[model samples]
Target: MPATSHPTRAAVAWRWVALVLALSQLAAPAVTSALAGDFLASGATNRALITPAGYAFGLWGVITVLSAVTAVVIVRYGLGSWWETGILIDICIVFVGFSLWLVIAAQSWLWVSVVVFGVMVGALAHVMRKLIRHRDDLTCPSWAATLATVTFGLYLGWSSIAWFANVAAAFLDEGWSAEGWWWQFVVLVLASVSAIGVTLMLRGTLGYVAGVLWALVAIAVGAAQRGSPVLVSTAAVAAVVVAVVAAVTWQRLGRRARISPATA
Candidate 1:
């Protein structure tokens, strides 16, 4: 791969860009809060059944720290591989989209924010999938690449549940009440299933599983507090199911790792 060659100036520039973007997330809470409200406050104001508790939003802090660390790793060790370059570009897009989302949300463009959030998720997912698929192929330090992969994986995992919450909030904004809405519960089920599916597909990437589980657990907690017993039950069930799937995925990944070395 071309990444096996010397890192080019362009690659170095992208690496720095990625690093800047990562650090900028540390400011997102203050910036977004000033523009409108903090992310959790905004979601709470536009309450939805799937909206997680305030504690869940704390994941943003964790993700921000991990992102900064990953960016520094990439800048230090990125080998100009195509995947490295692609990831840098995609991650930048995610952060830019997030800034745009804050503006859109401030304007109370709930529907528009929905669309923008989807695009951000897609971009993050692409970066994460690429890193996972090509992890072993990268010419960069494997530990560095793995850290980058986990950072994006965690981002994507959180976005999976968040996207649904965003959709539910949009519906509420448009005056669509959850009252008498059996289908809303169905949507929650779908959200859980989707999380499980992604974890399975990713072969139990630990960061991804951790992110999804964190959100789901928070959903259950928030639902119980909000007196949405049905949502609480659904989210609890989903969390368990996701845990089981992740365990299976880990086993499979372990088996693959064991067998591949023998074949080699």
Candidate 2:
């Protein structure tokens, strides 16, 4: 009758679901790519890529690794604690639903893809709230929860931005092109918002790292598009500046946490 004695039915069910979803994601790039090529060749869409963010999609692998680590951590804890149970359920719901939706959207139903991505963002945000609220109870040495939380936040935030970019690109390809500096303005706005949100979520060193990654990806994309070299360079420089600030902030927070009796 002990809480940690054996795996509950819910836990076993979720484990199976997670296993299947993880395998599906592993197979996704090949499957989705083939389907996308077919769609483009048939003139269903003018695009040649499955994701708007290009190489940014690799972050999903990082997410999957983190999720696997989290699952291990949860199992090690014996699932006695409500916090572990809650986190496990949240992750299973998020990953399984998110992966299936992306596969379907990439293969077909391009327009409805946006809604699927939105649901993912919402699911991850819920997980974030849970983590922050129960940060004190998370004492796993692997730091799985913390790492997963931040990684998921970064992925979701960047994915949201990429979604908007994809939608805009699709519209433009459909003869809704922007004029003057409108597209640039739109990209800048989206990047700024995403950067700010990431900064708030990550805070300190991790935040700085996340910010630099985001800024670099943005600049790289701009440069690849043959955008103004000066503008791209400026973005790169700005990213470095934000990175420095984030490092300093992270260090300060670490120092404070170390000195605090609770952390001590």
Q: Which candidate number maximizes TM-score?
A: 1
lDDT of 1 by residue, 1-264 (tens): 334767777778998998898888778767878866555575523377667887788788888889888888888888446556776788888877777777777777888988998998888878877777766567876777778778888888897888888788777777777552365687788888889888877877888888898999998998787788888889999888888998987888889999999999
User: Could you estimate the TM-score for every candidate?
Assistant: 0.91, 0.69
Clashing pairs in 2: 204-250, 205-250
Error of 1 at 50 (Å): 1.5
What CA RMSD would you report for each candidate?
Answer: 2.2, 5.0
TM-score of 2: 0.69
Misplaced by over 4 Å in model 1 are 1-4, 37-46, 178-181
**Candidate 2: global Cα-lDDT?**
0.54
**Candidate 2: RMSD to truth:** 5.0
lDDT of 1 at 193: 84
> In lDDT terms, which candidate is top?
1
Per-residue lDDT tens digits for candidate 2, residues 1-264, read 222345567766665565566556656556766766434334323231221234555666766665566555555543343455655566666676666655665565655665666666566656666565465555544365566556655655555555554454455455553432455445645554555555556564252356245635664565445444544554455466556666776788878888897755
